[model samples]
Target chain A: MKSSRPPMPQLLEQVARSLAARKDPALTGIDVETLCAQLRERPPPPPAQPRWQDALIEAQIPEGASVLDLGCGGGELLHRLIRDKSVRGQGVEIDFEAVSQCLTLGVPVLQTNLDEGLREFPDQSFDYVVLEETVQTLHQPLRVLNDVLRVGRYGIVSFPNFGSWRVRLSLAIEGRMPSTPALPYRWYETPNIHLFTLLDFLELTSEISARVVRGFSLVEGVVRPLGLNDNLEADESLLIITRDPPLA
Target chain B: MKARLRKYDPPNSPTSVGWTKAFTWRLTPPDTPWQLECGGHLNEVTVEYETYGELSPARDNAILIAHALSGDAHVAGWDRDASDTHRPWRKNKPGWWDAVVGPGKAIDTRTFFVICANVLGGCYGTTGPRSICPETGRRYGLSFPKVTVGDWVRLQARLLDHLGIERLHGVVGGSLGGQQAIEWAMAFPERVARCIVLAASPRLSAQGLAFNAVGRYSIMNDPLFLNGDYEDGQGPDAGLAAARMLAHITYLSESGMHQKFGRRRRVAHGPKSGFGVEFEVESYLEYQGRAFVERFDADAYLYITRAMDYYDCAESWGGGDLATACRRVRAEMLIVSFSSDWLYPRAQCRDFAIHLCRAGRPVTYVDVPSNLGHDAFLVETDAVGRLISAFFNPARKGWSI
Candidate 1:
């Protein structure tokens, strides 16, 4: 997906143009072209990719498809989908502040807890149900997963992998609950009540008679193909859950 | 000079719409009588309505606000002609919902044309129990036909037609008004684009019915009630005061009352209050009751509360099934319930949203946390206003962070 943030060159040019046009006494001594050159000579930033949101878009959801986002935080992903993919999106968020943000983003949202399940939605009501990075925080993650799959044909879920090497190393060496970039919380203050690895999630799908159509390992903010040791290597996992397994 | 200042001055807010006047429209004439849901008809009906802001050229920006029990058409702005209109109750303050309906407020008067009308059975400047019956040439005190929430919506549609508004951008209300808002979507599926129902349910609860029954009983048992034909200003003041006092208790939560009054005694008075006012809470309720009797009509109260009691969305729209009833709504729905509002409650509003969803309607439900009970919809302006303004104009960039 295209980033709304302008590239470095375009941003610098915009700043330079504004500076050159200004007649303010304080800015008169500043040279616009020199500033632009100084800013651009720095190391080029990495390509903006591998956010769970970007990974979800890579799943190639059809244009104008109906999307329901459970626990849509400030509706950033849903808004991105609507703007870029022209998808009709709805969001369910439990926080009022986040719900207000979703409204301002022009995404239809309901303020509801996920633990209660998506009983408001009819069966197969949407083309895709995205539960990004919210499964572990729920009291009944399995129950919500069942409902998510029941409500939409495809369920795209992303969560922090507890089996990541960094987390394991932290726990083993320090002898305390681990805190990584993905699960950045102390034991008592953590919102993540249920912790599971990538393999545990894949196992959960099979137990519920669901199948994983696609899986991505996101390590250090880079998306990679699911690997044999991904359960211990990946920081986060993204999966496309469906009712039937993929063709051989 | 004091009365002049009170009647003519606008509110202190810069966004105030200034002073407003109530306008009368002959909505139903003798030839085109309004049909009632209770199998009755009324002819030569007049409606008192007030409008704020300009209608968009496309006429789609009109929002009709339905008032709750004891509310009137003066929904925003100070009533300039309150004395002339004989609605002295409106002179001292701006509209009941002034907090949320100003130029830059939630239901922004700058962008949307806001219209509020006194209900058909209302006491304030509308054809109610106080209005003379065109056929009998007498006041329709006990004679007024039992009106329903459906009747109110149908009449509102007629008012819209008279105003040349083909469709509404939105309809909003709290309590009884919220029920009307829902009824608008169900009754005129093609007319409304959005509907916001706050602090209301599909029907009044059994406990609510019990309270209304006792209030009506108080009014009826009064000697001055005189079978609803007594002279004006001499009819059931005591009974009406008692009724208002009882109903006011239901509109506030125990926590709110505790925070406001606690168990503290009135410090100014001695402790020798046998049945008189000793507790501050008692004095507050007495003032509320006395103030209500000065403004509202006992007969209109009976009709309105009865109408509220009779409202069953499933029974009226569906054949005893809520999901079937929900299918009639075509507008996007926003249902809000205050957390401490036992009068309507959050659970019932959630059920309403669930049914709407089951019927394939696009709905958003929020339970706003407040200890103000049902009154929170009116008092908790900042939170409610943000939610409303965002709902109405979603997708606008640079909304407050």
Candidate 2:
């Protein structure tokens, strides 16, 4: 299908310029100073304090252990871990801007959606796979949990406890969606899709034959020992689970 | 340091390597038979390479640059003459990626020692189809046992070992070269510190294999081929030319063709055309094919394309599992793909990137927009070079700049 037309005007112009120019555009190489200027324009994110989940997980993670944080938003907690705990911190964040922010902070982060599962990694590649305040927002929480346990030696699962007394009271008495400090979203525009309580999460781990290594309960941003009615009283809950090794 | 079609240099004419020098490594290790993927073995193999810049005292800043199909060891600059006259390839030819491999360019020879080697089953100085077979005392020609990407990678590792380089700062390559880079990182994980893979995937696509199959068929069906036994003045020039033309098509973008050649014919006079080249693209392809026929060996083409086709790094390492195969890699990976490369396609490279990520390996994947097709890595200089330098900042590691 060859027609008898002349070379395109754009093509002719480019060739003419290419022939006339001494320093070809393709060979001019990047300007390091310009890159530095551009990078300076977007200053690194301000320093921030660690999340409550960081303290909860930090107590268990040994120094120099490899830790991967799934749904690591802006990688702040991972940055703190790398800085203070002497751990190798890697993060998988879904948000593009958040990943860029992480890069600015010098925290290693990969962009990927958690709902699709962590099928990219081999078995037990990391010491810990953490999902802080993010599991309830996932599309396939069960499959993601399986993936977390498959890749990391220890899996840390933390979420806002939906069965907390405040949430229960808000829903039952006021007949409105809970607006607690942790679950800071309206009913119509909330990202928390499969929200579950501490009791429900425990039941799930047991159903899958997962061995519970440790647990934590936080009420009103403060770490508190779980009582008999922890599911109803606690605002936030965390668990450490070790998956039984796959069949040989 | 421009990326352009090299000016015509007469074959056998004196030439000069403008920016770099070359060397040779004899790959003969005791008890290791230089085993290849297709069950072939070479006892004594010679590898020709070009080195740039000075190596660090710690020997940690060495980077291996793998050449693509039809590419030789002359990656940057031109060597007019080699002290080793036994080498049969042109020494003075300008390097394929000269713009990207210079002193302050993307790979930046000023900061790291760069090593570019001619691959096995190539027509260059390496032990390939044109090299003399020790047993027969003649050229290997078609007798050169089929080689694979795995063979290229293994022989390269031996060459590095001979150089006393315990570990490489990075393994960098594009196209077929990228395949070797991935294999190096996967097979000899401890040796490679980083992988700079541009426009490459872990395995060849079905369509890519089909394209290569057509090229092989064209060569094998030629009357002058004589089952790859043709020599001297008698060779399969026509078949090889056709194969090169086919390959050239895959290396170009539709947008590029439309922008550059379009429906443009070679001549504007009254139409009385019969069978000759009518369009500009046709003429360009013909010239490319003829120039390639003058330089490349037909037998080498058959073996190398087959090697590229047979390459399945994931299957070779972990028995059909990609993630498991990549688990051994210790180097951080930087993967780049072009938008116009329909040949390798973004989906394939993206899948590879995703696997690297899932394996918990450090990776940064960039999809750059371009009209240069598969050759964008070689041509889209300013943008690609900046991306590479930014991604490969050794400044953070406290390496002396």
Candidate 3:
């Protein structure tokens, strides 16, 4: 088989880079007091969840439930689950800064690309696979959603609504891609390539033979059961969806 | 406080733990007996162990270090008279993972109390096949009870209990040691707060089993084996050497071997037997085998390799369920895999991390790209050490600083 790794010289260079980048070279000499003091100065991370984050997780989680947070930035949501709901929490995030933040909080996180598909995990491994505010940025949303349903008993997805009335007003008046409180980035720079509304999500789920078991809408950081006008009124959505059961 | 540069050993004087220290805990009569995995039992088990740092008042901050197949309690450090001339290839050989477990090391001794013990089936002063059996007044030899990674973890726990340590702040091990670390978290989930497993798989690969089996057969086929009944000092050294040579192959990668030895001949002008020791690789392997047999027990090697082969995290608490097996562990895990480790490949280690996630356990996985094969877990300490230190220093989701 062909070599899957870099040549020896390149590998040595990589090793050299790591050795040089170590926080402390005194692998056996530094004192504990100095290390602990250095750790403390690293400003304590935010102690509580933001309003939007709290609203996104307001849905009741059953006791002993297991949750996986996709794009679990700093693991704030998962940490909250372990603390308040007393459930197990896991995360899949790729960003280094975010992963380090998650590590500092002591959250179990897989530093892997979500877009590659959750092929590594077994079927229905988690009670709930949560994709909060990260679905729009996904390169393969349809495939990821399908994998989510397959890997989790229940998949909870939350994302900013592209169909909000404010978004429509901006697009209608200015004739440019809308940027609102939800869609905070300009169209050219936004990471959310597949920005779709609640109606679009529901239609896509149905198209893929999945069922939305319980759907809720969050408006101005307040979550409530989904209403007919939620597609136009709600700023975001939190939907508990699953693949439709096979018919006999 | 900086560690004042103290005395150094000969051979260029590499930095040491900066002091002379040796800790031993030998379990005798009053000590609790360890029930074996194969139905046999030992009433008294002597566990030669070394400790670093002071245990916290809450008995936390204790990290149990499980050595690999050939490793001993000497995880890192050098006693005053400890010699480093075991091998001609290495200079000032301190502990196996000295770079990763010192004062400012990843498993920093200054911040966390560390305890590394010679495993039950180990030849390093632990009760092994070479130890005299109290019942028979003879070495157990090949008759040593079949032990598993689970058995090793059980005995290691007793060591903790004897030390008045109710729980381990973390448990860390590489290769076979990693298997024991996993078993510790599984068998006694409440006792371990964190688990660091390096270059290990949940289940032994078929290739791994094949290699181990070959090693076993090499020793058994030797006439000097004497059916595992040979008297002490008269045992089969050649057979043990052959077995170790076989095992050493599995521990390294083809690329690594090529990088280290290549096709160079051992002698420029040499008379050689046509069928033996032609290449430099053969000479290297032979030297490793000879050196290994001197420091290890053939029977102990047999026992430990068997223990490693029998390990499968999915089989026990999970009942063929990875997630279920994971639910049995409360410790957050840092699973590391080397890129070139064919013995326990990166894919398997990644799957382990995935399984832990599936089980809803907190887990982190770091891939250390290397050409060092499975042995990288022991030698490639720079990145691995940093990962461990970073993983351990942070408090878990429920833990308070």
Candidate 4:
């Protein structure tokens, strides 16, 4: 049967035109090769090692676990598990090219937007569902987290902590959206239309009745637990959450 | 022996194929040989790679440099007097990825032997969609089996075996090359001592995939594609060019664009003038697209991009757990991100570090402040070079000095 989809080139042309017209001034024109070379020449900053998430996952995931990766881009993370951890996995993404790339890489990825819902997948289908840097983009972060909690035995959420004093200061003093290395885009062009801080996420998790298995902030790549004593001035943080109580 | 070699030579004067050359080496996987997921076929495929640096004795100093999209084995320092305007390994003049891989540079040939391979589905000297199928003399074209990062990594592993190297000091790559670096550490943890993944992510971002999809759609939509069978003059040049243009845009940053060609009039002296492509940026994009099509194969473009699209490490684990994937990775990893690179931003690199830390893997993450976007990894050589040297330097570990 002939598919009803438009021809690929025409669709691409339309998208190309739109992209060109809507090119972000902040991201538009630069010689990348030249710039990349320059960046490579400098000494890298001190390494930041985050160890908390590693401990939590190791303690939680049993042998031969099934995983579902939301917004699995380029299969880097997914491929890591398959080859290193020996875990079975699947991914869902809204981008057709990404799904195609995933398929090319031999990853099983379904091309679908999470915000639209995952009716195609049955409830409790995966041992774990991970949302890596995906919370900020969703129009409804709470619903997506709820759905992720429902589908997997455990959930992992990681995002830049907007509550960090640096970000808050940028908002308070600079009077503009913060553009840290973690969140580089300006207010008008930011992909994160729905911004939330680490504390905001915790409150939402509580309202949804999700229990925080373990949560920590990454300082210079080192994973440290989120606490009042610790400095919240760091740029990024990761949170690992689970459903409350025991499943009957 | 010389007389015997001469006797075996062809009667007619050998005509140089000109501009391009390819070489392939058969590779057997360490585990269960490569199986094409699309058709479930067990296949023994050969990886075609090219070399830029001389090998040294002891062979412990080899640095395998992987290429990103539209890049090949021709790292740099090509013979300028070579017959072809387009050097054997590089298509565009001056060559892409040349800024960092030459002598006296970050990946200095004096220190490390560099070997770069045209990826499995690449148009350059590699077994790709353009290559004639052994079974059916015709090119595989669209019929070529889909390839994955694992497939590429397996091929590279074979290349390493062929070179008689049991272990590598480091594997450096950006973008897709970065993906290959990640796979190398995962697939053969013992083989790689240090890995540098630059401006690369653990998986494809939805935004990134959307861009890739549009690029592919642009290519496949051309009527000349002829369902992937356009072998003659009627090729999908327009679509391919459009795809290249779109991809070229992603490689650049808006700040860079503004700095280089903001609202500038094109052909300032020419009578054939208008607002169309009046800015230097538009002309640059056109030039990039036009130059790209002169060498790249449309089918290979489709296949390779598809491979990138399908890349997801977590999917294979079935648990959707990125941390689990890194549990077994033994190599010390250095993940770098550019502040300006929206394509594969710092957020993605942070995500990778988070998972690696969660898996109890030793990883160093650096978010370099730069407005160079994703391309910063290539051009910011001085910065990246120092980081790599320090990271790999065993003497510098744990000591503030």
Candidate 5:
């Protein structure tokens, strides 16, 4: 999606300029002695706990299982596995900082460009592979799915559905990219390099000889089974469980 | 005050010595000996530091830059020689932290009086395992106290007190330097207004500890270690080199290694068919190790690495709750992590940020995109400098200093 805002560099420069212009006295008003006293008096704050994904992985992952988490930003998903599942999970990321974050967390992660093929991992390297909110960002969704199927016994893919009637209506009426909490950034700034519909994914899966183990839609953060009359065109999110065909 | 010359100098010193030729100023803080986590004890300790910019009349504009494991107190600017030996201030070597400490840079010497001190267990001017023992008047060697991160923080606090600068604008560092920065904010939150922690963790991971352990083991197991008292003229240069090589590998990324060496052959011709020092990477690592040995002490390496291994901020508070540990911090913080740095990855940094956020502290977290590995913070000068400058900009309402 083309961003409505200025280019990334220009936006960053603007932010920097705005920050540079401010002169808050609270930071500058204190005397050295007073500041030292203040520093000694104040203690540091606590760390944040994991969110919903952590809970989901904890409840679902079997003990001692090997998992592959794609687009695992900062290795948070792998950390959840290590802490809750005691599972050894590897992550694939394109961003260097996110990989560093994984290392700092002490989780094993491989740096790979997801748009390309996953030739790095041998076939069936993982019992389960998860692609969380990552499919929409891929330029070649089928290639990723096929690769995941090759490396994992089971695959969990989640994506925001452009086929949702709300999104369709928004686009039809507003003629501008929709910006919901699910899709926080403007079109030009969004990392959703490629957007796909549920039907498109299903078609790709059918062509790749993958079988859907389970399918569900999430609306207003509630997960429910997808029924014939479910009207996925209005659902906010979708999750699919698929299995790759046995070798040969 | 002129920089003091070392009382003893070994013969055959290189004629064109590096920056050490330029001597500026020095100060001897009051001698306060202390014990280490290890059984060793030190009777007297001295800290060496350097300052840039001016201390305002009110002494409120002081910024402290903590050095990494191998860093000294020379943060920026040139030495007396006017050459590029200490080019942190000039555009030369750029002083290890020149990006963050120059006139218009993030730390901005023009506005903030910046002080960078070599850690307590450092081989620099500070007293460490390499310093002379007062009782025997010989280099302490193995007899030096095994210091901890806490001890280093305490010494820094003492230095601040001596300077009569009660509060700091902020404490900034990356890698081990980041450890010191976090400790300063936690230990004396009221004394520091802000903290910039880049490529650091609340505690050293087991993997990190393991790497450090192997590095230390390499040095200690060297036949030449001689139980740490290798002062008989011969020392564990081989072991130290091996340790440096291993640790250096961690500092860089796989891609970086490929780009730097990529199985390229060295100029030397020997055992080309076998596993000799044929790769350029091997030669480069050797050069790094050899250069390190010339300026560093083996005993100091043991103390510092041991101190790093023992670094666990959660242990200091009570339980292993990092958020609880930082509950009292009033300082704003900026926690930065690099993408390719497998050493201190982004998840740990995010955890730090989450904890800070949970504790209701204001913090800005940036995961910079880079493939330079842990060393990215030092090499990605433009991005880091921009973040630091923005973080420390005095005009910002919440963090003007």
Candidate 6:
């Protein structure tokens, strides 16, 4: 929605015009365009969708549960959690514009690079730690996963399934780095450094001695229980893992 | 020198608040003396304040602004008695914060009723060292009780009560004013719904305290200081000016200073002079110091900067735990720090935000990229205004994703 207020650049221009009309000395050598350029922030990109958000919401986290969202771009999912489930939500994001949006949405956020690790949070400080569509982009996905398990009772992770039929077919037939809707960036420019399939994700959990409490296969906005064929059928996967055994 | 100062809103500008009048609120009577943090009591207390915009029927649209050390209650609009007042500095300029507090500016006086008051121990018609004491018919001078940021908030709350405002929609401030905003949140969380703190931290660093000490030393040691009891027109002007000149350096960035006056000789071809303003930067400081001495009181400077030196949010509010103290704040907060403000570094501001978040408080921290130094909060009005307007009215589409 467009605001009734003029954007900052327009306001500057209006001020300049008014000053010129008055022949005010303040307008003598000032560059309104340059001032406007300094104030302008790059426009934010539209948020993408991954069905894990829907699945997470469907899981219905207990009221007032503490949640920590890593790489919470624009804080959309966290905002939903706080509004719908009454969970205490905090966000960590590296993007300046995204952090500003989170604050505008009344989300508690810290602007710090996730590569530094979550050293600020104590063990089991949060009831749930969420990593959405941001795992493959990390330098050490396994180390972050371990830290997530250490800092939260449950870790909810969502990532694109590289073994999906479409991705595999494109790589096999086209003989080029695959570009699907989920992973649209070219190989040279892609942020995903550790792309893995659902099976690979399950193997990672076992490698860390973590238990998969639940798993879901998400395809074209439809969510289903993880099945034997999910390694190739699922376009994306959402896994709920924990260091401790599942509660009775 | 005149060109260096900011341009003010014309008397007839549509966005200008136009003519404004100051009001005095007698908060404390002789019988009911107000208590101070130092265990001193004020027999009589008065606060000079000004308000712009109309209060909503519900009285919920009021935003209280706190000013920095050298600021006054005249936050916006042309002071009606500027020329009549002793302080000639107020004659032409609208107000210190007129940039963001006009009719359609950042704080948007048209939408929110804004109130700003001259702080205690200030010379701007507020009860201070210069005001005649009720108990002793003479100027308080050095007899004035010490004031803290907490005391300022308490007195402001009384002022609000007098105005019949049970709660504030927001409290906004920069520099020392920012500390007041933080104090308001922790001291009276329920009173303020939102707070915007620009270019401030939990407390003054050791280095900051040292610099303040030197400024105070300069004032007290002036040959004409007369132990802070000199005549009204003759007390420590030289001392105060020197102190101001020294402080002026801290408020600027190295790069900003270099850009404005990069080894430029004022005379262009002057042989070695004994001791005068030869360098452009020195000339700039001399003007600033002289201008500051014209409007500010030497005794009040000692008292106010002492108060600033004493402020420590963690020690006062949280038993020395910032996160614990932050737990007391219920208001949504927006903390802004400038990139080049070495006086209150961005890292310190970040730590403050971190503690607030650790306490599970709703806070938005932004380190705005600027080379304007500590004074960026005032100079970078456009950026600061945008953040404040967006924070106050979140429904407005200031940033999209």
TM-score of each: 0.88, 0.68, 0.72, 0.57, 0.60, 0.85
Candidate order, TM-score descending:
1, 6, 3, 2, 5, 4
lDDT digits (tens) for residues B246-336 of candidate 5: 8889999999789867887775455657775677887788878876776566778888888888888877753777767878677877788
Off-target runs (Cα >4 Å) in candidate 5 are A1-248, B1-31, B35-41, B81-94, B267-271, B399-401
In model 5, state the lDDT of residue B347. Answer: 80
Q: What's the best-to-worst order under DockQ?
A: 3, 1, 6, 2, 5, 4
Q: Please give the lDDT score at residue B387 for candidate 1.
A: 81
Each model's lDDT comes to 0.81, 0.76, 0.76, 0.66, 0.69, 0.82
Clashing pairs in 3: A108-B363
Model 2: per-residue Cα lDDT over B178-254, one tens digit each: 88889998989889877878889998899999999999999999999988878855789999999999998999899
Model 1 regions more than 4 Å off: A1-51, A83-86, A245-248, B1-13, B28-31, B394-401
TM-score of chain A of each: 0.77, 0.75, 0.75, 0.72, 0.71, 0.77
Model 1, span A194-215: residue lDDT tens: 9998878888989999998778
Candidates in order, interface RMSD in Å: 5.2, 5.1, 3.2, 16.4, 14.7, 5.6
Provide the RMSD of all predictions against the true structure, rounded to 1 decimal.
Answer: 11.9, 17.3, 15.3, 20.1, 19.8, 15.0
lDDT at B283, model 6: 89
Tell me the lDDT of candidate 3. 0.76
Q: Could you tell me how far off, in angstroms, the CA of residue A190 lies in candidate 6 after the best superposition?
A: 3.8
Instruction: Judge the docking of candidate 5 as incorrect, acceptable, medium or high.
Output: incorrect
Q: What is the CAPRI rating of model 1's predicted complex?
A: acceptable
* lDDT by residue (tens digit), candidate 2, A32-67: 344234323523222222368777688788877888
**Would you give the TM-score of chain B in model 1?**
0.94
